[model samples]
Target: MASSTSYPSYKQLKEDFVSNLSGGTVSEIALVCAVAPVVSLLWSTLQARQSFFKPYTTLGFVVDFLLNVGALLLSVTLYSAVPILLNLLLLTAALFIYALPPNLSRKKPRLLPDAKSRAAASAGSLGVLSTKPFLTNYRGNMMVVTCICILAVDFRLFPRRFAKVETWGTSLMDMGVGSFVFSAGVVAARPVLKERADNKYIPLGQRLVKSLRHSLPLLVLGLVRFLSVKGLDYAEHVTEYGVHWNFFFTLGFLPPFVALFQSALRVIPSYAGLAVLLGVVYQIVLESTSLKSYILVGPRTDLISMNREGIFSFFGYLAIFLAGQDTGMIVLPRTLKARKSGSQWTMLLTLAAWSLGWMVLYHLSTTYKYGAGLTVSRRLANLPYILWVVASNTALVSGFGFVDAIFFPAFYNAHDSKTEKEAYEASTSRILRSYNRNGLVIFLLANLLTGLVNMTVPTLDVSPVATMGILVAYMAVVTATAVGLDMYNISIKL
Candidate 1:
């Protein structure tokens, strides 16, 4: 075991390892974003033809693990070397395999024989809700990418260009925090929309309490992480969040702050407009005043100053959350209605338009001659960063929806509830669903394992093959745990 006297040196070494990265080009980052959907499409295609591959159950699990996790590992590492070729190959394979007919055995039992009966059995019940399997798959894919990158970024094989940018730029890991928050905002739209439609607004105090209750677990986790890092003398990146603050703290306190303004937010006709107003105002404040300096270069004398990055960036993240909510409002309704109305084209067009619109706005914001000349910064989470995160994630969700619509149209737009349900069950990625069901648990486990690996091995000094092997083993453990829990119908929700 390493001695206590050497801990600080190890800390410095690890911190320096990830420092000063400039991140990748926007197109490269966008390509990385496309990886999850592409992999999901491949997995879903294989899953739909499970009857054809029924004899190879063990091979099925292997393929599922590879697509769900291994492909992501490659995206951040090897894919950087031959990105275009790898992406084209995966996509071409997906389309080719999808075109193959599922030769079902006549004697094989159907999973759901009476689809209509099953639908009728649950009719007029709370279970019959407007659901979107693609949304679930999108969230699952995001979690997988996030889990892969957290530890991979520590290895030599992981591309520095894909790591989190130091001050300002785009990167694959930089998208992790913003995208997670945005995904939360996306799902949050359901309840927000429900509240508005039901016209039963909870009291502000009660909402605040509820928000606190929701945030309490995250707060505890943040404290545990902070204490553990300090107690263990772990490698700390002060600028990433702060001296004592972590991502958990950022995630924890955001909800309560947003809850404080829930009433005001309700008054606004559009959440997107509110997001625009907030983002513009926040950007103006950053440009016109010393607030940006206070965050970027200010003295860390007190608690607030020490954690300025996490504190001030709150506004930008809040704006992002709102924008995501608006996006959900736009996209979710179409998804729910598409099943009955078969409006796949409408949903597809809506997603494409939103993706393009946000990307254009992001381009405009970062353009020196035509626009604000601001760069995307995860630390600051400024206007351009917000636009970029929203655009990229929206594009990812759109890609998943497109893949489902194109390759699994029967599953995506079944005419009746029974067929749709049956098709969804058949085509959905079970491992991805497991990850989705217990996201927080998986993330926490990944963090724990990342720390364990860094402590046990010199991640910065490992060879490429060693790095790959370690990462594969790490992800296999994580996914296997998720699958096991899912098999037992266990979800460790926090």
Candidate 2:
């Protein structure tokens, strides 16, 4: 729990950001830039061929494997952090490398058209870009990876604090939760929105019942996880969702409520509208109850009160999820097609504006809350926190859109063209696609590995560099397994 009076000063915040930005080394940047492509290329080749051991693909994997090992050794043996700018530059370069032809003489790769691409073609120019969900799977996989990375390392690994103790501000951990919930929300909302199951023709009670039935798996998983963590005496971080509750509660509880609201109302509200409504209701609850006390201070007797943070925070998380669904509704198309450069830029500008607007609202909400001597509280999942999530995520999605629109023109432009869009996509990021294909399985595997590592190793006591090495190796193992399964078209659907 954070103290209201313990907020960091502005100067401290600036210093921390600077420290974080300056943490990486030149060698680290070059290494990341060099190895990333090979990893992607290997995955792509294996996926495209669907063969375990082809001569060219096997060689690519061998080279990539050696690179991964070398990178790990160098990072642990010699310490240097990769700067944020270098990361950005590397990412941009990688996109260009993947999306564009390397030499004029080389043939352009071909990609099999997906449903999104097909839908975009029918939507026409501007409508095509706006009508479909934009790379939702890729974003979700990124979240899963981010979560795993955070879990793999202890706080001692970082040189600076990522978040202030008292403010519900932008910390890596806060963003992790926000990203996870927002992605999960979109997945939950997909079927309902696509099928029009939320029609008012359905009785509210029936809708609620059906929703609850659908959520049974999440509830069961939540119970099993809680027992596993408690029963196993795994490393417990008090701030990580406390003892009795976890993210599954929010995932399990929110969708049914969303369905109920959709069923009861004559006109379905936009995702943003529902989010605002939930935020207002949450704020009212915060002012009206002793919920804050139990969150920051533990209960004397009742265990449930001690875990009320998760219970209370569910609404704000739900709002974030609903907002994601709305964005999905606008950006995701049943099909996609190539558009003119001008149209793509127009779409990018629209997303940018939405991001900026949400950020301004976040700032205003934070300022208003300060008048009452309260800062943002991630634990509470307050209004400011929800706004921050929407703002940041919208901005992130917009950036990805810019990359996809500008660099990967084939995805949008393949309507009547002879381009090899599918082949190009495969070559560029088979690893990411594979991970996305079985994101849930990978996430579950990461969790299982996290617990196993915690039990076997002293994560907090380990040297920071060694921790980084371990994390890299762990991620490699996870990625290899995911890519391997995806090559065989084996998805563990749960």
Candidate 3:
């Protein structure tokens, strides 16, 4: 009997990898980001003599708590360790304040309903997180810790060799952990991130301008950043993307690119194929001529010109962006519902299959840096890594769906709804919901937070773990605060 077996082609494999990579990281964080708001809603409900817990909103609290652990691990560390001490101080103060005969808020304000509360202002952004009567207690610490991590960061590592300018300009270290994933994933998960579901019928010029606007941030940042490479140009140095805001530079154009793709997606099958063709052709051209230098180089209008490595590689990124948008259309479900349990086994099997594929790529690319999964070259996005991303993410969604199925009666922890599990909380939901809407904003703030951290703290003397801890705690608070501010700044037109 003819065996029903066929391997994913190189292109197919890579496509899958990139798709899941974008989806997994964003969705996971998005869920985590949702936690506090939903919790707020739940708390609000309980205060109103409502149900035990809100609807799917409880998922937001779970997501926040889980993600905070991850954020602390990735962002906190020795250099920005002030938060550790400040956290202690804040906790002590909170304990003393709460322990007083009267609620501190009573003497000062009716804190909850007061329109004056802002995420960055509230002790815990008014999310009512934590496992005690001290929910609001951690709010103050959250802000200081957030500021310390973001504003007072020092990305330097000790006992490590000095990094050359070129290395920093090009390597993944300059990008930060999950940095490329942020940009590449944005490009990949175009459908969901974008607000357009019916842009297919839109025209091209409109799309171009739309793309321009979305990419403007990256475009401007890219240009300015290129200027930042002046020292590297003269001294034969390049950056490794360490603590630099490259994620913003790469992702700025995404908003517009997505808009363009949506307008052009009516024939996604054909256009998507064409996008791949265009990418292949562009890559071949780079490899064909010494024009790689000319083509890769950006606006050499001066002595200290920025090398627009990714930006100048327009066809390359455009291909990737289109490929990503297409992925959302092809793989994303129109509705959130499960038809059967078989999907779980299917997802697991696929994950295993993809993991095995990555192993093969890794073994083959042993000579390349970063496990050859993502070569240290800024100009190239490794095929294997992209595949790993897609598969990894697809697997997450699939597995979650399946698990939700098996434990449908027990473990229903999915944030597949706009609202929470039930309407138990009120004020909290309104606040956290604002954060979900401000994801890209949160990301930008995180970059600025990183910058602020760099300006104040000197990471050169600290350990990576310590630095990571500081940064994560700081980011968590900043994220919470920013979300709170957004809620307060709500605008509507009738």
Candidate 4:
């Protein structure tokens, strides 16, 4: 093993390597986004053939791991070289499975009730169970992609175009943090959208306290990470989130801040409008003031100055979260209703329209050079960046939704009748369920493993083959940890 002191300081070397590179084209990044859902659809198709594949058994879990996570790993590493072709192959497999006899699909397990009973139950419990499997799939897939990219970006096998851009452009990794925030907002919207049974409202102060209580873990994690990085002399990308601020702190503050506006979130008819308003206002502030320059090139003197990127970008992330909440409001109920009716075309089309609309807005914001006059900047999380995050995440979720509707409609609709354990076994990939169950743990583990790898190996100098081997082993360990926790029914929630 190479000694840490033998090479140039890891911090300077890593920062210099990643700095100042423009990201890939939007079309290419979008294609990369499609790979996850497409591969997931193929996995769902295989699960549907339970008679042949014997799904819900231990054997089935192994297959699920291989097909879902394994395929996703390939998509981001090797198959990334030919994303279009990989997507084509996955889509072809899914279509072939779809064309099989309807009888070939898994029969409704004995635990679930009939369609009518399940529908009534689902309607009655909608408030309690607003989350559907497809949402789980979306969040899990996004987590997988993020986990892969966080470490993979250091390797030669990972395409430079997909790495995070220094200032302003779209890339797979650029979407990671924004998408994670957006996904959190999606799930968080459930409670916001749920109507009070007695028409009673919780007081804003109480809500703030509760939100803060929930966010406490994130704040602690942020502090721990900050101390660890500095104490251990870990490689620090100061511009990414600033010297002291990090994603955990950004995540921590959002819930409490949003909680302060619980009344507004409820009273406003259009959360999307609220999101746009926030984004536009922030963009105006960035354009008309010196804040942009301060964030981009200003000297760091005090605490605020040192963490300018994380602090200023909080508003943009908040905007992205609000946008996601708005989308969740639209999609969650529709997804449940569609489960009963086996029709999701209207919902799918609505998501498509929203995605296209956001994309057009993003284009106008970047192209016309009128207002904001900015390209997408993850560093600043400005208007264009917010729009891009919303657009791409919505599109990715839409793709996952389409896969569920077309490839495994019966599984979602009928599986609700199963017991909790049975449902876990009978539904889509268990690996995804595991990932969903232990997302925070997986992320923490990935971060630790990333640090370990950097300390032990010359990640920047590794050959492509060695990079692939390291990535595969890293992902395997992460995946196994997720599965093991879930196997023991251990949920390490924050």
Judging by TM-score against the true structure, name the best candidate.
Answer: 1
Instruction: Give lDDT tens digits, candidate 1, residues 126-185.
Output: 222345678878999888889998999888788888878888888888888899989888
Mark the 10 consecutive residues where model 1 has the least summed lDDT.
122-131
What is candidate 2's TM-score against the reference? 0.73
> For each candidate, C-alpha RMSD in Å?
3.8, 9.1, 16.2, 4.1
Provide the lowest-lDDT 10-residue window in model 3. Answer: 126-135
The order of the candidates by lDDT, greatest first, is 1, 4, 2, 3
Q: Cα deviation in Å at residue 384, candidate 4?
A: 0.4
lDDT of 4 by residue, 1-494 (tens): 86677666767888777664688888888887888888777877766653434535677666776676777778778888788998898889878977787554456544444765765576443333435567788998888888888898877778878888888787888888899999988888777656443466778888998898879999999999999889988876798989999899999999987787567765666778888988999999998999899999999999999999999999999999989988887676635545555545677788889988888888878885554367899999999999999998898888888877665555445433433334434445677888888998899999999989988998989997888788879988999999899889999989
**Alpha carbon lDDT at 397, candidate 1:** 84
| Colliding residue pairs in candidate 1 | none
- lDDT (C-alpha, whole model) for all candidates: 0.80, 0.57, 0.38, 0.80
User: Which parts of model 4 are misplaced by more than 4 Å?
Assistant: 1-10, 50-53, 57-59, 96-128, 195-198, 334-343, 369-373, 411-425
Regarding lDDT, does 3 or 4 come out ahead? 4
lDDT of 3 by residue, 1-494 (tens): 99899976533432232221111122333232222222232233232333222333556444543333333333233312233343344345434543445322322233353443342243322111111111121121222233333333234431111111131122112222223332243234543433344434446776667557657766676556555444333111222222232445556665565555554555644434645455446645655776555533435553323434444434444554554444344333322234234433443455446445534543443335544323323344333233333333333333333322332221122222212222112222333344333544554565555644544554455576676567557755765665566647753210
* Model 2 agreement with the true structure over 1-494: per-residue lDDT tens digits: 87678786433443333233212222333343233333333333333334322233656555444433333223222322443343455456445555653333334344366855775465443322222213533353353435344454343564333322233434544665777777666566555555563342556777788888757877777898889977875544444465588877667787687876674234646777878778868877777887666666766356666567777788888889888876666455434333444555666677688888887877677665543333566778888778877887777667556645544454554443223334234334445556666776777777778777766776656786677678767777777887799789898754
Off by over 4 Å in 3: 1-67, 70-153, 156-200, 217-249, 254-279, 291-305, 313-316, 335-376, 382-436, 462-473, 486-494
Better of 2 and 4 by lDDT: 4
Q: What clash count does candidate 1 reach?
A: 0
Better candidate number, 1 or 3, judged by TM-score: 1
